[model samples]
Target: MNDEILVPLDLSDAIAMIDRQKEQIAALTTENERLRKEIKEIKEKIKLTNEYVDKYHGLGDRSLEDARKVEREIALSQSETQWLNR
Candidate 1:
């Protein structure tokens, strides 16, 4: 048999905890939005870079590698955003 002890929480303490949780949720929402915006900006930059590389260098090995790196970054950012949404 397992025994469990329940500790009583005061109303003020419960309210404080709720307030702290709200603050944390707000902070996380702000951070998530910021990250999403940053990811959009980065993706736009990557598109421009890809275009320039294609036009000027015809996607040389180094440029191709850089593009792959940007793609990975985008993938990771998207996954993070999805997780945040969940």
Candidate 2:
């Protein structure tokens, strides 16, 4: 009768592959959270900028009316001065 021997398989390589996959998943999760925070901050900044622009639009109309009033007063003063000189 002849005898045969069987060798046992090693599982270290499989365990290393699983560890690498876990590391990749962790990295992806961290990157996703960072992107979400950045998006939120950008949206808030846009909202603030829009509000500032709207406020300035109202101020611009008031400034234009004031400038027109000043110009009329200057013109009337110049006309009176010329009449007095004559």
Candidate 3:
């Protein structure tokens, strides 16, 4: 009957183990919230950068400013008048 012995679990050891696991779970929850906020900020920054690129770098006529311009007067010369000649 010595080989077939029964034992009872100590309640204090089980309570200590549960308390440690609860602390670990609380730490993990706080770390998860921090990571979530960090990801949100990163996504917002990426969105702002994309908006800036689209506003300033997309399909704009930046080369037209380099073309040269000249000022000149246009005149029309008439050698004869139609009513006087007729």
Candidate 4:
């Protein structure tokens, strides 16, 4: 089997290659801008979700505190009833 020798590219061919690379760079730049906008939108969504989570946890803490206060009151009332019975 005969092996093919590699030929050197001429100057015009190299310039044409550079022009193609420039076109690809322009296309990639446009794509990059689009991706950046998408990333910014995702970040905003994440921020809103974090704010909602914070609000939900804050309400849960208040609910838990109120429940504990009610439990204490019920215990006090039971103790008073027992004393009256005795």
lDDT of 1 at 83: 88
Candidate with the greatest lDDT versus the true structure: 1
Between prediction 1 and prediction 3, which has the larger lDDT? 1
How many angstroms is residue 53 displaced in model 1 relative to the true structure, after the best TM-score fit?
0.7
Model 2 lDDT tens row, 5-76: 222122555677889999999999988887677567556655654565555556787756655555565557
* Candidate 3 TM-score over all chains jointly: 0.55
What stretches of model 1 exceed 4 Å from their correct place? 1-9, 58-86
Query: What's the candidate order when arranged by decreasing TM-score?
Result: 1, 3, 4, 2
TM-score per candidate = 0.55, 0.50, 0.55, 0.54
TM-score of predicted structure 2: 0.50
What digit string (tens of lDDT, one per residue) describes model 3 on residues 12-70?
Answer: 66787999999999999998997687567556655755565555564456422221110
**Candidate 4 residue spans exceeding 4 A from truth:** 1-9, 59-86
Residue 10 lDDT in model 3? 50
Which residue pairs in candidate 1 collide?
Answer: none
Cα shift from native, residue 58, model 2 (Å): 4.6
